[model samples]
Target: MVSVAYDGDEKTIVRRRFLISGIVQGVGFRPFVFRLACELGLSGWVRNIPAGVEMEVQGTAGALDAFQHAQAHDLPPLAVVTSSVVEDIPSIPERGFTILPSADGEKNIQVAPDSALCGDCLRELFDPADRRYRYPFITCTNCGPRYSIITAIPYDRPRTTMAGFPLCPDCQREYDDPLDRRFHAQPIACPACGPRLRLLDGAAEPVAERDDALTRAVELLRAGQILAVKGIGGYHLAVDACNPEAVRRLRERKKRDEKPFAVMAADLATARRLVVLENMEERLLTGPESPIVIARKAQNCPVSPLVAPANGWLGLMLPYAPIHHLLMRDHFQALVMTSGNVSDEPVAFEDNDALKRLSAIADYFLVHDRPIHIRSDDSVMRVFQGKPLFYRRARGYAPRAVRLPFKMPPLLAVGAELKGAVCLVQGEQAFLSQHIGDLQNSSTCDSFRHTIRHLSGILEITPQIVACDLHPDYLSSVHAAESGLPLTKVQHHHAHLAACMAENGLDGAVIGIIFDGTGLGTDGTIWGGEFLVGGYDGFRRAGNFLPVPLAGGDTAVREPWRMALAWLYRSLGKDAFDLDHPVARHLSDTEKGIFAAMLERGINAPLTSSCGRLFDAAAAVLDVRQAVSYDGQAAIELEALAEGAGVSGTYSFGIADGEPLVIDFTSLFTDLLADHAAGADTAAMAYRFHATVARAAVEACVRIAGQSGLDRVVLSGGVFQNRLLTEMVYTGLLDQGLQIFTHRLVPPNDGGIALGQAAIAGWQRGC
Candidate 1:
C-alpha cells in the first residue's frame, strides 16, 4: 500500500521499515529492537523472520531518526548486522511497540559463533543471591554456547540441543519477558531445569553427579590426575599445569610429544603471570571469541616448563565458561586444556565416544547431559601486525559467514588433506566449517564428511558445484568424485592465492607467494614453495623452489634428515658427505645406499619444490630436529630456535632461468653448510636460514612484479604461519615499495583452503 505522505496535520509522521540480517536471531535482536523503539517513543512491531529481524517504526521524523541511530550504533553485544535495509512505509495507526511471533520466509540468516560467557552472566554465576549461583551453564542472551548447541535455524529453543530441557517457571518467565536479557535466548536455562554435570570413571561408571561432580573432578586435578572435561563444542583433556609429572603423563597418553599445551588461567591477572600479555593479546583472551592466544612466556613463570617444553612461546586463554570459572576459582592457578583426542583424531564430542576413546588418556570424565550438536575444537590464534592470524578457526570463532566481495553461486569446497576444513557458499556469504582437523585417519575423514553435511543441512544449502583439490587420492577429493554433483578441481597453491584474494576483497590478479609442504603440481610434481600470479578466475605459476628429489616421498616429511640428505645430494653431489654434516655422518651405510638409490633412480621419490621440506632440511643440518613427532614439529622448533637467537643475518640465494623461474638455494646450502663446518652457533645459523628465505621471497616478488606488472603480493600457505618469517617477509616486501597482504581473518594454512576453493569454483560455469 502507498503511504499517505501528505495527511492533514500529520506531515511529520513517518513509518520506517527495516530488515536487519546476519546473526540477528538467537542473540536478542528482536528484544533489542523492541526496547529501542519504545525508548524512542515510536510505535512499531518487531519480530523474527527466516532471514533476519524485520520491523516497522511509526513516529515523528525526529523520533524515527533517533531510533535508526540507536539501531545502528547500539547493537546487542553478540549481534552482528551484515546488512541493513531501511525504506519508507505507510504510516500505521499503531499506539505502542509490540513483538510479534516470528514470520518464516527464507533460511538465510547466519548462525552465531559460539561465544564466551559475558560479564553479566559471570556476575550472576558467582553471586550467592542470584538464582544461578555457581551454576555451570548459567547464560543469558549476550553469551554462552551458540553454534555448538544450535541444530537448525531460524534458531529457537525448540531447534537446539537444549530442546529436551523444558524451561522451569523462573526461566519461562524470563523467556517471555520482552525486556529481559533471556528473552528469546535459545540456550536460556536455570539451575533447576538446565543440564547437570557428572563425573565418570575410566569404565564409564558414574562416580559423582551434579554439583558434587565438579568438586570431585577438581580434587582429581589437584592430585595431579588428568580429567576429560566436556566443553561447549567438545571434550578437553585437562590437567594441572603446575604438576610437571602430570603434564608429562598426559602428553605421553595423548601422543602429543613436543607440541605446546594451551593453558587456561582463572582470570586475566593469573594469565599475566604465565605469559607476556599485551593489550591486544589480552583482548583476544577475554574477547567474545576467547581463542587460545600464542604469546611469549614470562620469565620466572610458575607453570611447569613441561607444558611447553623447550619452547619460548605459550598458548594461553581465559576461562570462557562458568564451569571453567568455577574450576579455575577452585584455588588452582592454571590447567592445561588440550583437545581430547589421540593427537591425530577428531575431538570426542559424544559422551559414550569420549569415554571409550579417552579412557586410557583421562583418569576421569567430567561430562554433562547437554549434547554438542556439532564437534568444534578450540580456536587457535596469534596477534601479528595488530590483527588476528588464525592458526585454527573453530568453536567460538567459526561457522560465521565470511562476507564475500561479490555474490556467488551455492557450492562446496572440500579443502585439502591436512588441516582439513570445508566451506559452503550461498549468495555473498561463505560459511566455513570449523577446522575438521588433518584428514589422516578414518575418524577424521568421517568428521570431514559429517561437517559438510551438518553445515549444509543447517544453512539449508545444497551445493550446485563441489570443488576439491587436484590431488586425486585425497579423501576430500575422492568424496567429491563419488558425489553426484558437478566438480571443479582447484590446484593447491592457486587455492591459497584465491583464499587471500577472497578474504581481502581483491578482484584482479595479484602476486601470491604460497609456501607450504606439499600440493600436487599441475605437471604431476609436488609443488609447495610457489610464486603465482592470479585471482579467483585462475593463476599462473610465475616461480617456485628448485625441483629436488623428495627421497621416500611422503616419508621425507616426517624425517628431516632424509630431506637434508636429498638437498645435500642435489647441491654438492656425492661430495656432500665430506662436509662433516651430522645428517650424513649419522646415516649407516645401508641406509645411505637405500636413500642414494631412491634419489638417483626416483624410486618412491618424487620431484618436489615444497618450502616445508626446505625448512625440515635446514633444521636437520643445524641439528635442531632430525625427526618430527607431529606434522609441523621440525618447522615449529626451527622457528622457535631462530626466535631464541638474536641473530639477524641473511644467507645468499639466487634465481635460476626456467619457464617458471626457480628459487635456487644452491648458495644458501653452501653458506649454511659453511656455518655448520666452522662450528658456528646453531641458533644463529637457523635464524640466518630463515632470513635467507625472506630475502629470496622478496627477490622473487620483485622479479615477478616486473613481468606481470602486479604491485600487490599476498603471502599465504602453512609456512607463512611462522610469525618470524611472516614479519620478515612482510617488512621486506613493503621496503621494496610493493603492497603486501597476509592472512588475518582466515588461516594461511590448509584450514583456510576450503574458502579459496569455494571462491574460485563460484566463478566457474553455472556454478
Candidate 2:
C-alpha cells in the first residue's frame, strides 16, 4: 500500500477523487474499476461507502483523462451510475490499484434488482468441461439473484441468505481473484458447495435427487401432471401448455376458470411459434427483466385452447431461471407457468408452505434449499404505442427505487385493496413492493403485512407518516390506521391521478380523467368516472358521470345482468322490461320485479357512476356474458370482441354545465337500445360504445381544461387498462393539441396507487 509511481515528469502527475451513486455496489463495480485502472496505468483504490462507491486515483494527466472518459461509457452491466461527483485532489503516492473493504456510513446506495442469466454464464452453465456444468445455482457477478436474497446491506455475502453455505477452496480462489468474474459476487457457488434440489411427492418424502430430480419433474410435466417448481422469487405451478387435460385439471384444482395463464417458452424461437413478437416485445422477453410480455396468439399455434380460453392474447416469457431453462430445453416447447396460489391469494414461496398449500393442486414438488426472503411474482407487461406498459411490476423489477422530483420524509403508503402493493419512501427514492395480490383474504392480508415489514427492514426505513385510501373498509386502510403513525387518507381517484403525475415528474396542475370500477366518493356515494384538476397536494372534482343505482351492490359485480336491469330502468322507465331485448329474455318476471323494487326503494342499492359497470351492463345487454368468473372479465371480453371490428360510429352524450359537470349517458343508452332493436351486430355495437366512451373522455377533459386553465391531461385508473380505450383517448387528446400523460414506469391500475399516496403524504407534511 506504500508504493508510489510517477510515469514521466513530476509536473504531469494528477489526482482525482470520485463518488458514484445508484446501483453501483454489489454488482462487481469495484472489480470493474480495478481492471480499468490497471489497464490505463492509473493507481486507484475503490471501496463501498454508504452513499455509494468511492474511488481515489493518481496518475499521469493523460491516463487520468482516459479513465474519466471511460467511466461514463464503460461499466458493469448491472451498475447504473445515476450521479458522479468528481473533485481534484493533491497527488498521492500510489503504485497499484486495490479493492478495499466497505466503509460504514448513512446508507443511500441503490440495490440492484435480480438479473437474467448472462451469455457468458449460460455458456459456462452448459459447458461440459466447466465445474459448474448443469448446476442450477451457478451464478456470477454480472448475472444472478440480488434483491430477493439480500437481508441487510454493505452487499456482502455475510449479509445475504447464502451466508450459511461456505464456499469451496476453488470457488473461494475465483472469488478473491480480481480478474475472475466471480470476484465479490455474493451469491457465487459451485455444485459442490451450493444449494441442492430434490423431487418430493405429496407426502413430502424425497423421490429423486439432483439430475434425476429434474428428469422426474420433466416426466411428470410430460405426463400431464402439475408440479410446483420453486424458482428465484417464488413457486410456479407448472404444466404442459399443450396438454388440455392437465390445464383443465389444474384450473379446477386451483379454482381459476377463465383467467389466462402465463407460459414459459424454452427460448426465443420456441416463443415465436406460440405468440407474435415485435422488436420491443422481443427485447423485454429476452432482457434482464425477463417479464411476461402480452402478445397476440400465433395462427395455428400448437398449445391447447384451455390454457388461455377465449383470450386473443397470451402472456409469454422466456426462461430466466437456470432451473426453468433446464426444464424446458429438453422436455417441452412451452409450459404453463402460473403463480402457485389459490384464487385471490399471494403466491407461495417457502418450501414447506408450498408443500402444505399446493399439495392439493400439484402432483409433485421440485424444490431447493435456497431461501427467498421476500416473495415476488413474475412481472407482466404489454407493448402499447411502441413502448412497454407494466401491468404487474415484480420479480426482476421490484424493490428498485424510483427517483422522486424532490426529497421526501420517511413514509409508508398502503395501497388499494385490489392488486395490493405497499410503498416506503426515504429521501428522494420511493421503493415499491412487488404485487401483493388482493387483500381481501386473510392469507393475502398476512402476506401484505409481512411484505411491508420485510421491505422496510431491508431498506432501513422507519416511516413517520402512514397513508392509505379514503375507503375505511379496505384492508389497506385498516392496516394504515393501526400502524400508530401520523396518518393521511388520500382520495382514491386523486391517488390514481397523483401516481401518474409523480411518475412523469410533473408538479403542476393537470386535468385527470380517472375511471375505474369503484372508489368511495367524497359525497358518500361511489365514484368511478371522475374528472379532477389537481397537483400532488390536492385536487378538486371538476366532472363525473351521472349516477345510476347499483342494484344488489356487490352482487351486481358478479352478475352483469343486474347492472343491465339497473341501467335500463334508469334510462327507459318502468316499461324497460317490455322492450324486446336479449337481457329481457334472460331475466324472469319475478326477478325483474324484485330488482325493480330494490332500485326504486334504494334497498341494498348504492348509487355509482362507474364506467366499469357501464361496460359490464353493455356486455350483459348484448348477451356476451351474463356472469363473470373474475374481476374485469366482462369488460375484458367486450374489448376483445371490439378488437378487429371496423366501426366509426359513436353514441352521443349530454354534458350538464355546472359546478361539477355531469356526463349523462341516457342518450348513448337510447342509441344503443335502438341499434339492438335494429339487430345491429354485437361486435359493431361494442366498438361503437367504446368509441363513445373515448370521445366522451376527450370532451370532458377539454371542458375541464378550459375551465381550470390546465391543458395537461393525465389518464389513470383501472379502466385505462383497456388497451383500445386508452389508445383511443390518447390519440384523441393529442389530436386536439393537448399534452397528455399516461403510465409507463408505474401501472395505470391500483398497484401504482401506493406511490401516489406516499408522495401526497410527503408533500402534505411539507417534507
Candidate 3:
C-alpha cells in the first residue's frame, strides 16, 4: 500500500522559529541566515538577541527542510553554532524574509571575534570608482574586524568601537542594501570618513599623508631606515631585508638575538623568488589568512645572513592589510617585519607605547588612528606533508571555533608550555585562542590569562571544568588551577595523540607514537618518547624509550656533555667509554666530574625516555654540540650535518618483550670512536646516527603494526617537526603501504595541545 502524507498544500508552508545560542553574535551568523533564508524563499524576520540569533521562517515544507539542513551545514567559516532550538509556529502570511532590529534585554549573544578583511572587500577597495577605494578600513559582511571592534553584546554599530564614526549617507545605502556584500557591515567606512594614515619622522613630526605616508614608509625601508608600521592588531618594526646594517640595528635595539625574524614580501612573485612554493602553499600564501610560510631557502636570497642564518628556512607571510598592501606595491618586494618589542616581551599596540618603547628600534614612524582593542601577532604557518600546519594562529585565522562531532558541557583548557594556546568549549564548539607564547615568563603568562578571558567572553561560556597539562611546572597549569574551576590533569603524550585523532575525526582506538623533548610521565619519570594504543577517553602504554639518568636536571638542557655522560654510563658502564677527545675539553673539569658523579650516584637526577634527549646525546657523541646557545641546538646542528651528508642505509633497533630495545648505542659509539681514531669526518658520523635513529623508529613501527590488528599509525609530538625525521617516517610508512596520520590544521608540536585537551574533556563528559 502506498501512503501519501500532506501538510495543508504544496504552496502552503509551515513556519518555524529558531533561537541559536553560543558564538552567534558578531561572527556573521545573521548574515549567513539572511543568505540561507533568501535561497529558501522563506518569509518572516531574523535578528540578533542578546543571548543569540532569533529567526522565524515560512516556506514550502521541502524548502523549509532544505533551509534547516543548510542552516547547520552551510554556516559561515567563523560561526560556531552551539545550540539551536526550532519550534513550529502557526503559519504566517509573510511574503519574504527580512532582517529585523535586534531584540534588547536578551543575554545569550555570542560575540564574534575579529577577522582579517576577506578577498571580496579587497576587490572593492581596489575598485577605483568605489567610495571606499584606498580606505584602510574597508570591510564587508564576509570579513573585516569583528571582535576587535565590538565593545558590548548584540554586535551592532552602537555597541562597537565603530559607534564613534557615524556612517555617511553613501555608506548607509550600501549597508542597508541586503543584495550588497557590505550590507550591515558595521565597520564599513569610506576613506573620506574613515581612519587616516600619517607618516612621522624620528622626532614625531608629520611628514606625509595617506597614500603618500605609505609611500614614504616604503621609501624609508628602501633607504635602510627602520619604520614602525601600524598593523591590524599592533605596530611592527619594518626594515629592508637587503640591508644588513638595518637588520643588525633593529635586532640590537629590540634586544633580540639568534631567534629568527619573520618577513613580509609584497606578493606571490616576490615570495616565490625567496622560497619554493607548492600549489597548496601558494594558495595558502595568497588566501584570506595569507599566513603560509614555505620552508625552502633561496639561493643567496639577498637578505642578510643574520636574518635566520642558522636556519635554512625563512618565515614569510604576505601583506594582509590595506596599508601593508600599499606599502608593498612600490618598488620593494620584501621587508623585514619583526614584532615591535624587546625580545620576550609582548608586541606593542598603543601609539604612545610604540613611540616610547620602540624609539631605539625604529628610525621613523608610520602612524594611524584606528584604535586597536586587542593586540594580535601575525599568524605563522608552514607546509609539511603537502599540508599547511599553523605554528601561530592569529590575525587571519582566529576566533573561528572548531566544531566537535559530539556535544559536551562547557570546559576550558590551558595548553602546554612553548607555543601555548588556550581553548574554550561550549557544547560541541571548541574555540582555541591565538598563539600565547612561552608561559615561563611573567609577561607571556599575563598575555595567556588575558587572552583566555577575552576569548571566553566572545564564546559566552563559563567553563564548568578546566583542563591542564599534568606537568605542574608549566605556568599555564598553575594559572588554570588558580582560576577556581574544577581541574582535570591530562597526560602529555595522550593529549598529543588525542589532538591528531580529533583533527582527523577519528574516535576509535589507534596506535600512537609521540616523541618530543620532555613531559612529566605518569610514573613520575620524564617522557618524550612513547608508543600507546588509545582513544580520547583513555590509553594503554604499549612501549617507550628506555629511561637513563639525567645529570644537573635543567643544566642538561643547555649542555650536551651532561646528557652524553649519562648515556655513556647506560651504554658502556662507568669504565668502558672513552672521554679524552678534544671535545671533552669543552666542559670544565669540575663540571665533568660533577656530571660523572651525578650519573653514578643519581643525585638530583631523573630518568627520561625522551627521543629528543637521545638525539642530543648522539649529537654530543659526534661533537656536534658541547655548550648549547639555544634550545634544540644539538639536534638542529645534527640535522644540518646530516642534510649535507645525505641519506644512508637502515640500522637495527632490537625488540625486548613488547618494547623496542634502543640498541644501547654502545656498539655504534665504539665504531664512531674507531672512525675518529682513523681521522674520519665527524659530519658523516652525525648523518649515520640520524639514519640509524630513523631506521629504528621504522622497524619498531613495523613490528608493532604486525602484532596489532590496527595498521594505521599516528605520528605526533614536537620531535616530528624535524624535517629529516618527518620525511624519513613518511617515506617509510608509504613504502609499507600503510595509512598514516599527522597534524595539518594544528601544529604537531605542543602548540596544538589545547585542541587535544578539549577533545579528551568532551569524551570524559560522555559527549
Stretches of model 2 off by over 4 angstroms after superposition: 1-12, 60-62
lDDT of each: 0.89, 0.89, 0.76
Candidate 1 residue-wise lDDT, 160-231, digit = tens: 999999999999999999999998787888779989999999888999988899889889999999999999
* TM-score on alpha carbons, each prediction: 0.97, 0.97, 0.87
Which pairs of residues collide in candidate 1?
A: none
- Residue-wise C-alpha lDDT for candidate 3, range 408-450, written one tens digit per residue: 7889989998888888887666777777677777777778887
For residue 322, give model 2's deviation from the true position in Å.
0.3
List residue ranges in candidate 1 displaced over 4 A. 1-11
User: How many clashing pairs does model 2 include?
Assistant: 0
Each candidate's clash count: 0, 0, 8
TM-score of 3: 0.87
lDDT of 1 at 548: 86
Which has the better TM-score: candidate 1, or candidate 3? 1
Comparing 2 and 3 on TM-score, the stronger one: 2
